[model samples]
Target chain A: MRDIIVVAGKELREIVGAGGGRKGLVRELLFIGIFGLLFPLTQVEAWLSGGVPAAFALMVPLFLVGPHVADSFAGERERGTLETLLATRLPDRSIYFGKILAVCGYAWAVTLLIILASLLALNFGADVSGRGGSPTAGSGESEFFVYPAFVWVAWGVGSIASGLLLASIGTFVSLRSKTVRGAHQAMMIPLFVVILGGSFGIPALFRSLPPSTQERFTELLESMPAVSVVLWAVGGLFVIDLVLLGLGARLFRRDRLISD
Target chain B: MTLAVHTEGLSRRFDGVTALDGLNLAVPTGSIFGFLGPNGAGKTTTIRLLLGLLEPSSGNAVVLGRDVRRESQAIREQVGVLLDSDGLYERLTARQNLDFFARVARLSKGERDARIRALLEEIDLWDRRDDPVADFSRGMKQKLALARAFLHRPSLLFLDEPTAGLDTPAAVGLRSELVSLAREEGVTVFLTTHNLLEAERVCDRVAVIRQGKLLAEGPPEAIRGGGKRKLEVTATGIRPALVARLMNTPEVIGADVDSEGRLILALADGAETAPLIRLMVETGVEVSEARIAEASLEETFLALVDEDLNGRSRVESASGEHPR
Candidate 1:
């Protein structure tokens, strides 16, 4: 456990300090600068309302996690630090989990911070100084912006589940990739497929189904409670995470790592 | 003997091609043992096997008194390694690289700080501790790497071509420090290098390998086999007739006057030297000095490798097999 923390800590430091340190962290810093502070301030009223804006709490973190995930295994090999780290007394599991945990922890923490900053922007913006909308959006009474209780739970669970899933997939890609660029390129393939398939292929396939079947599917989705659908989605993602993580552990072998 | 590293029939094969053949070795505790070989001789493979980075195909090894297969983590905890790569994090500062590894070694706050400082100063990199490793020269990085390997004060260290990129002075300094570490601290050093002179100077015992097999293993002098030695005789009057006289004798397989007018005689296996000296004196060659020229580690290494190659060829021809 202690070794895990130590490895995780070093990994975080390296991630935070890569490229040229602060100058190299332009992307990450820009992320917090925009989403956390500026975006909320610019769209105060809509951000305060819970819907698509609230969904950013989940989507933003996963977006932020993608590139960093590639750095977990493939980056170390590219940077020539993998062999030395493997030579250490650190147990294999610790090193594996440590890197995955670091990626998740950094992305998750940033997500939470973005949420906190957004709240601060909405509640304390110049337009909302008197708890009423000012020049930022339409002039109207606006109470302190706060997420509903369910909003917090929903996005929090959603972000974590999606983050782990993406990171697990990234782990497998990174282990096989010789370069970070290669890993990222490989990761993009499935991501595009999933997004495109969900966006067009599945719907197209559904349209190809019999009209009666389409009606039946619509009826079933509509009959299911919103909370139950969310729970089912989260549960399915969790199972995929487990399977990918199990395969990742199998892939993380000392000899294979060295040979690769 | 109390062995720090022992291997029995240890071997590794890749896709039916053997990288390390069946081998046996016993490295004594608290000694600087040099593993010498040309490129592709499986020196790095042996180190990897002992460190449990790679599993052996048909045998086993014990390092630091733990079975390499079952107790690799234990062995890793007590041994330090500097492989083909320096293994330094290039983006991090020199201090940060050492500190991170020191932390991984689980040193206390106080120990980590003190050790990092001492090592930086020892390597003369304390002034540049804040500089990233990528900014340092190859020699400086190599020196820092050596310090990092010693930070935890490991009982056994496996250094593969540790000084390959260092300057002469830095290499000398590191060699002295290596001797000091092994002598005063009782640290066992398993070093592999192509530098036969360096091996001869610091290594208590050395082993030579070729084609993934052990060609010779012993003290430097021992491996420079005693049979068929060379003798150099310097005299006031040396001529072709004298060389002919020496060559005619059964003990002298070959004889010639060298650039300095010394008769260089290649003696037959375990041949007596007294008869040659008597013959030289009787020939009235006015012999001034006569001494058996000892073979250096490099010469011995080459001779052993040549013998192994020729022997392998002969065996292959006899067995009607194609030479690899």
Candidate 2:
């Protein structure tokens, strides 16, 4: 356990310090500048009231985690550090889980920062727009914007969980890939499937289903509370995370890792 | 004497091609043992097996009194390894690389800092401790890697080609340090290198392997001494007739006067040097100096490798099989 923390700490430093350290920070600031400040300013009232914040919370961390997950193991292999690390007294599981934790932890932290910045931007924008231009779209009373506690807990924690899931999948692919580029290429397959299928295939499948099946599905979804639906989604993602982690452990063999 | 490493019939084969053949060895504790082999001769493979990084096909090894197969993690904790690869994190500073490995060895905070400080200073890299390894030259990185290997002060260390990329001064310095460390600290060093001269200078016992088979194992002098003795004689008034007479002798296989007026004789097995000298004296040729030239480790290594290649070829020819 101590070894895992040490490895994770070093890995976190490396990830943040990559590209001479300043480049990563610059890129991160660029992200915050765009998504946190500019986008939130334009979406002022809708950012807090609509689903934009939730979607950004999910997708932003996932985007941040993708390259890191690919770089974790494959980067070590490319840099010739994997075999040395493997030969150490550190257990295999520590190295595996340590990298995953580092990736998820960094992405989650950045995602949360982005969300907080977005919230701040929304507050400042709401005040400016309310005083000078127009009141908040629907409500007549213009007041200080405060996101609900549930919103904080939902997106803050939920984005981390989503990052963990993506990181797990990335670990599996990275462990199998010989290079960081190879890992990224391998991860693109799953990313594409998820994006295209979620956007079009699920809806297409709904259209193909008969009226009776569609009505039953709609009734079941409607019967469940919104919180329950979120819980079910979280539960399903956790299950997938566990499966990917298990596969990753099995793939993380000394022979396979050292061979290439 | 206690043994630091013992292997019995250790072998590894990949896809019907043997990378390491059935081999047995006993390396004494606190001795600088050299493992000499050409490329693909399985030096790295042997180190990996002893470190429990790779499983053997049909044999077992004991390192630091622990079974390599079952107690690898324990063995690794107590051993240091510097493979063909330097294994340094290019992005990490020199101090960071050593500190990281020091942590892996589970040193206390004080011990880690102290050791890192002492090692960096000892290797003369403390000045550049903050520079990333990638920014360092090849020699400097090699030096830092060497320092990292000994950072934990393991009882046994496996260094593969420790001086390959080092400049002459750095190589000599590292070689001297290795010798001093082994003698003063009682650290057992298992070094593998193509530098036969370095092996001859530092190794207490050296083993030569060719095509994954152990060719020779003994002290450098012993391995070199096993072959036929060579005698160089400096005399005046020497003629072709004397050389012809010496060549026709039963014990002397070949004789020729070198450019320096020394009669170089290649003696056959079990040849007596006294009788050959007596013949030169009887021929009225004045004999000034007669000394047996000792074979060098490089010559011995070449002879052993050649012998193995010849033996394999003969077997292959007899069996009508293609040589691998």
Candidate 3:
């Protein structure tokens, strides 16, 4: 147990000390800040045109969480630190859990920033509209405010799981590859396939509906929610991460590194 | 009385090519055993097998009294290894690299600091201890690697080509340090090298390997002792008849006339030099100079390998198949 923590701590410190921590935090902050400034302008246009304000809420988590979770393992392997971590006496599960925790921590922190930025943007937009004598016309819809919370919860959970799954898969790919570029290229293929499939399936399911049916579908999509889908994705990815952790452990033979 | 490492018929195959073939070794405790082989002669393969990095395809390896494959982790804790290449984490500073491995090895904070300091000083790297290993010279990196291997003070150490890349002075320094380590700490060292002279300098016992088989195993002197002894005899105005007369002696195995027509005799017993000198003077050979030629380890090794190859070919021809 002590060995696991020692190894994990060392790995974490090395990752942080290697400049990944600072670079990632800065990139994430800048991305969120830019997106935050853009959100209110878009939201004001939506309000003036009388479209739903809640639709913009989903983009915040997607933009903030997506990049944070996606680059965790791929970046580490690219830096050549992954093999060094495995050479330690740490158990595979400890490494897997520790990395997942670190990535999730970053993801959650970014998500919180996005939420804060969006709220500030919404408040500023609302105040500007009130001063302009627009009278806050769409204030009756509490769902717009509530939807951001739901999106945060869903994105936070889904991104953590998806990030862990991708990190583990990336680690596995890195183990088989001779270089980081090779590993990154190998990981991108499967990620592209999964993203393409999700884009095609989810949108098509909502399209085949009458006007009344579309309204009912939108209500169901909001109220019934996709938390289960997020949960299922998280659960499936957690298992895959465990299995890949085992494989990465086995593939990390000391002789191979020494010989290389 | 204990054996630090023992292997019997250990063999390893990658795909279809044999890397190590039926190799056996026994290294006694408190001895520096040098493993000598040519390139691609399975030196690294043997070390990997003993370290439990590569499983033997046949037979077994028992290192520090534990089966290598079954108790690899337990054995790993007690064995330090330095491979030919730089295995240190290039991104981390020297201190960080040592500290990280020390933590993994379960050393206490105090012990870790002491060990790291001691090793860095011993390797003469204390001044550069805070620098990243990527900035280190090859010799410095090799020294750091040596320090890391000895960090745990393991009873058994496996060093593969430990001084392969060091300059002459650095190699000499490392050799002296290794010799002192064995004598003072009673550390059992298993070293593999193609440098025969280095092996002859530090090794108490050495095993010569070829094609993954032990060609010869003994002390350096014993291996070098089995070759023919040359006796260079200078006599003033010596004739063929006088040379023939001197060659008739029992101690003289054979005698030949040099280009200057001086007689050179091959002696079966180098110890018979005094008697041969007396006989030469008494026979009026007018002895001017006498010296017994010492056979070198390189010559002995070449002769042994040649004999082994020739014998194998003879056997192959008799059995109607080409030699492997």
Candidate 2 chain B weakest ten by summed lDDT: B313-322
Measured over the true interface residues after superposition, the C-alpha RMSD of each candidate is 1.2, 1.2, 4.6
Per-candidate DockQ versus the true complex?
0.61, 0.57, 0.22
Model 3, B186-253: lDDT tens digits are 99999988788888899987777777777777677776666578788777867667667767878888
User: Chain A of candidate 1: what's the TM-score?
Assistant: 0.79
- What is the C-alpha lDDT profile of model 2 across A63-137, one tens digit per residue? 888888898988888888887888888988889888888888888788778888886887665554443232234
The complex in candidate 3 yields a DockQ of 0.22
lDDT of 2 at B141: 88
- Runs in model 1 with CA error above 4 Å? A34-49, A120-142, A149-151, A197-232, B226-228, B233-245, B255-263, B270-291, B312-324
Model 3: how far residue B129 lies from native, Å: 2.6
Ranking by TM-score: 2, 1, 3
lDDT of 3 by residue, A1-260 (tens): 56646545654554444444356356666757765556555765443331222223323333332332334444444545444344344554555556545544554455556555755666555544333232233565432322333344445565555555555555555546565456556766656655554567657766876779989867865676355544554577668767876776576555554344
- The local lDDT score (0 to 100) that residue A124 gets in candidate 3 is 55
lDDT of 1 by residue, B250-308 (tens): 89998877788788899898788899998878877787889997778898778777878
User: What range of 10 consecutive residues in model 1 chain A has the weakest lDDT sum?
Assistant: A131-140
Q: Give each model a TM-score.
A: 0.86, 0.89, 0.74
- Screening candidate 2 with a backbone cut-off below 3 angstroms (N, C-alpha, C), the clashing residue pairs are none
**How far is A230's C-alpha from truth in model 3 (Å)?**
4.5
